[model samples]
Target: MSSRWLRPEVYPLFAATGVAVGICGFSLIRNITGNPEVRVTKENRAAGVLDNHAEGEKYKENFLRKYVRNKHPEIMPGINKFFTDPKY
Candidate 1:
């Protein structure tokens, strides 16, 4: 009777449903707490400021940040040089 509910074939369906529920729950929690990507302060409430600090935090956590930080010379050295280099 109870064993009927514990079939091997149902495990994948259960796992997938769990994952979907988890994603939905996470999104609901984030929506309730306010998205970190959007900066809403007294001054920027109406227009919503560009949250560079949050963006930087996100970048710092990225998988590439660890390798890129040590290997890359600059964030965009060529473009920076093109703009900053004196034109004579």
Candidate 2:
């Protein structure tokens, strides 16, 4: 209202310029960038997932077994709350 150059009506022009600059900059960068390569290929996917899962489960069981042997000394591994119903 008071300043001529800093009028509220010029705010939209500044916003539009900012958005245009952002889009132009993004487009320029993307145009120069290469497509990402997959470090793990399809051949490794299934086996890697299965192996990791089995290893993780083995670690969990071993850790829990050790803890039970030291602390509880009575409770079995399969009898815990973590075990689901066989039907599922």
Displacement of residue 48 (Cα, Å) in model 2 is 37
TM-score for all predictions?
0.41, 0.35
Look at candidate 2 and tell me the lDDT of residue 78: 54
Scored by TM-score, the top model is 1
Q: How high is the CA lDDT of each candidate model?
A: 0.71, 0.59
Predicted candidate 2 versus true structure: per-residue lDDT over 1-88, tens digit per residue: 4597898899999999999999999766644442122124556444543435554555456544866666744356456534755643
Lowest summed lDDT window (length 10), candidate 2: 30-39
Which segments of candidate 2 are over 4 A away from where they belong?
A: 35-88
Q: Candidate 1: global Cα-lDDT?
A: 0.71
